[model samples]
Target chain A: MRRLYELLEQDTRTAGLTRVAVSTVAVLVVWQLVSMVVTNRLLLVPPAEVAVALVKEVETGAMWTNAVATVTAVTTSFVVSVAIGIAVGLALASSQALSLTAGPVLGALNSVPIIALAPLFISWLGLGFASKFVLVIMVAVFPVVVTTEAGLRATDRQLVEAARSFNATRLQIFTTVTFPYALPFIVSGIRVAWARALVGIVVAEFFGSFAGFGFAILAASQTFDTARVLGYVIMLGAMGLIGSVLFAALERRLAPWRQE
Target chain B: MSTAVRLKIEAIDKVFKRRDKPSIEALRNIDMEVAEGEFVSIVGASGSGKSTLLRIIDGLITPSGGRVLVDGRPVDRPGPDRAVVFQQDSLLPWKTVIDNVAYGLTLARVPKADAHRTAQRFIDVAGLHGFEHHYPHQLSGGMRQRVNVARALAVNPKILLLDEPFAALDAQTREIMQAELLSIWQETRKTVLLITHQIDEAVFLSDRVIVFSARPGTVREEIRVDLPRPRDLHVKRSPEFSGLVDHIWTLIEAEVRAGLRQG
Candidate 1:
C-alpha cells in the first residue's frame, strides 16, 4: 500500500528528465498547431521554422559570437557575485548585530525590482560590457548573500562543538565543519545567482549593446523575423535547463551525504 | 605519581537564566575526582546534568562557579588534552571516516601525510578499516559512533569524555559498541569519563559509577564495580554485575520519582 501510494502521489521529482522531455514535446505540438492556424508569416512561427532559422543562424556563425559575448558577460558577473556574496554572507552570519541591522537593508535593496534599474545602470556606465557586468552582479549577488547567510547559520551546533573540543581554532572550525556543512546550500544559491545573472545580462543587452543574444532577439524582431526570435528564446531556455542540471550535479558531488 | 588524580571537578555549578522565566539550576556544586587511567561513568535520570558535567570537563561550557582542573591546571577552554565522543550526529556528514578521524590532527598542524597515517591506525582500531572512504551518512549508527571514538582517539588525548555515546544505537548494536569501547579502553587505558543513563552500561564498563539527583543535579552516590578486567557480554549476566546495576537503578529511581512529584 505504501508503494502504491508513493506511485500515485504524482511526485514529478522522481520522474526526472522524462518529465522535462514530455513537457517540451507537449509545448512544441501546441506551438505547431497554433502557428499552422495563424496563417500570417509575421505573427507566430512553427517549431519547424524556428529550428530551420536556428540552424541557418548558427551556420552563418553570427550566433556563436553573440552566444560567446552573452556567456562571457554572465559568467564573469556570476564569478564576481559569488566571491563578494559569500564574503558578505559570512560577515553577516558571523555577527548578530551586523546581520540584524544590515540584513533588512539588504532585503529592501533586493526587493527593488532589478529591471527598473537596468536603464539607470546603462546610462551611468554607457553601452559597453561594463554596464551589463554591473547590472548582472547587482541582480545575482543578493540571493547568494541571503542563501549563504541562512546556510552558514544552519551549521550543526554539535559538529561545531565537536570541532571546538578537539581544540580547532576559529578558522579551522570554519573550514573543516561550518563551511563544508553549508556547501549544499551555497551551491543552490550559486545556481539561483547564475540564472539571475543571465536575465540581467539579457535585459542590459536589450536596452543598450547590439552584441549578445538579447541583441539577436531585438534585431530579429525589428525585421519581423519571428522564427529567429523564437530560436533565441529556445537558446535561453536550453541554457537555463543545462545550468540547472549542472548545479544539481555539482551539489551532489560536493555533498554526497545528501544523496541518500 | 601513577595514582594521582587525572581530573578534578571542584565545587562546579551551572545555572541557566531565561529572560521571562526564573533561572533554572542545571548543576549544583558538583565535585568529583577521577584517578589516572580509570574508567568513570556518570549516570542519572533525565535533566540530571550528566551531559552538562561532561561538557564542563571537556571545557565546552564554563561553570557558573568553580572550575575543572586537569593535572593541577585549570581548563579555561577546549583543548587537545581532552577529546569528546558525543551521543549522535557528531561526525561531520561531509567527511569520510578517515578524513573525520584526521580532522583533529590536521587542526594541530600535522602535515597531511602524517595525519592520514595516524588516522588510519585509529580507523583500524575502531573496526572501520574497510569503510575508510565512506561518508558518515553511509555508515550505520554503530559504525558512526565507532568513527566518533576513532576521531577522539586519533588526537591521543590524556582524557576521553563520552556523552551517552551509545544512547542512539539499537539494543544489539549498543551491547556490541559497549564491548568495543571496553576493549578500546583496555588497549589505550586513557583516563575515561563517560556520561550515560543506562545503569547496566554504567555497571558493565566503569570502575566507579557516580549517580546524580534529578534537575539541580548533585551527586547522590558513587558505587564501585569490582568486576574483572577485559569484560565481555557474558559477564553482564553475573550476579555481582546485576547487583551493582540494581543499586544504581534504585538510586536513580528515587530521583525520578521525586522529579515526577514536583512536575
Candidate 2:
C-alpha cells in the first residue's frame, strides 16, 4: 500500500492522472447506483451490465465492425473538411471582399442544425455512407473555417511590420510569420470540428444506414437490449475523449516550447 | 563620422490623415546629413515624432511631404540596406534565438547550414553564445533583446535604426545593453540612428543629438557630441557626459512641458 502511494505521488503529472482516473470511476459508480434505484433497464442500465455487454460485443466482433466503419467514415470526412476549410479560411482572411461575401452564409451555417438536413442528405446521396460523409463535411467545416480565419487574422501586427521592414517578399512573410503563428489556432479548430464530425457521422448513420455503430445502437434499442446500447454509447464517448486528447498531444508536439 | 554624407534627409515632411479630418503634420521641413559610421540619436517627448523621423529615414514609413536619400539616392521603401531594431524586442516567439537571427539570411535564400553558421558568429558577438537554441519565452526580457540586436546586425546593414530598443528593459538590463551596443558599434563602425526619450542614453551613445519640438516636430536643436569613440559607461559618470545631457535637456525642456500641458 505504501509503495502504491509512493508511485501515485511520484510526479505531478502522474498524481493528476491518478486523481482523474479515480474520480472518473467514482462518478460512474454513483451513476450506476442512481440507475439501479430507478430500476428500469430500458431507461438506464447499471455500469456493470454495460461493461459486460461491451466485452461480449467486442468478443463477438459486433462492436469492431461497426466501430471500424464509423471511424473510417469520420476520418475521411475530416480530411476533406480540413483541406477545404483551411484553404477557404485563409483566402477569406486574406481578402476582405471574400470574407464580406461569405460572412452571412457562414453565420447562417453556424445556426443551422445538421439534423435538420439529414433527410435532404439521404434523399440526395441515398441510404449509404455517402450521406454520412456529407453530414461530417457540413458539421466539420464550420469550426475549421472559423478557427482558421480567426487564427490567420490574429497574426501579429508587429511581426508583419518587422517583416515589411526587411523588404521581405510577400511569399516569405506568409511562409515564415503568418502561417506558423496561426498553427495553434488551426489545430484548435480541427480538434473542435472533429468532435462535431463524429456526432454528424453517427447521426447520419442512424437515420440512413443499415451498417454502423449507430445502426447497431438502433437495433439494440428495438430489442430492448439497453446494456448493449449503453456499451456502444460508452465506446463513442471514449473515442471522442481519446481523439481530443490525441489532438492536444499533437498541438504540444508541434509547439514543444508551449508545453510549459 | 569618417565619410562625408552617407545619408541625407532633404526637405522631409510627413502628414498623417485620419478619416474625414485635416491631416496632422508629424514632421515638417526636416533636413539633416549623417556622415558614414556616425552614431546619431533623435530625442523628443512622446508624439514629438522622433521615432517617425527614424522610420522615414529607414523607409519603414513614408513622409507624406519630403524625401530621404541614402548614398544620395531616394529611399522609397524599407530594404536590407537599412535595418531597424524596434522598441519591443520583436523576436519571433516561435523561433529559437539562432533561427530568429538567421531569418534575414534565410529570407535572402541563403542555405540553412550556411545561415546558421553565419548567424552563430553574430549571435556570439551579441553575447548570446549559450542561448542559440532557446526560444524567446525561455529567455529573460534582456536576453530576448540581445537576440533582437543580433538579428538586426546579422544582415550587416550600412546603418542600424534603433527605435528606443532599450526602453522595454529594466534599469540593470538597460545598462548592460547600452554597453553591449557601444561595443558592437565600435567593432562594426556602422552608421546608427537611435531614437530615445532618455537623455542619458542620448548623450551616452550619440555623436550628434537632433532634438525635435513637441508636435509638428521640427528640429529644435542639433547638439554635436564631441566625445571620443569607444567611450565606456564610465563616460556617463564624467563631467563631459553629464554636461551634454544637461545641454540637450535644456533644448527640449520647454517642449516637453508644453506637450504635457496639451495632453
Candidate 1 accuracy as TM-score: 0.92
TM-score of each: 0.92, 0.94
The lDDT of model 1 is: 0.90
Classified by CAPRI criteria, candidate 1 counts as medium
lDDT of 1 at B248: 84
Best DockQ among the predictions, by candidate number: 1
What is the per-candidate TM-score for chain B? 0.97, 0.96
Error of 1 at B134 (Å): 0.7
What lDDT tens digits, residue by residue, belong to model 2 across residues B1-263? Answer: 47678789988988889898887888889999889999988898878888888888878788888888888888989877898888885778889899999988888888999989989999999999988998888998888888888888898898899989999889988988999999999899999989999989988888899888866888888998888767888888888888989988888888788878988
lDDT tens readout by residue for model 1, B49-121: 9898888888888889989999999997988889999988788887788999998898899998999999999
Which sections of candidate 2 miss by over 4 Å?
A1-16, A35-38, A254-260
Output the number of the TM-score-best candidate.
Answer: 2
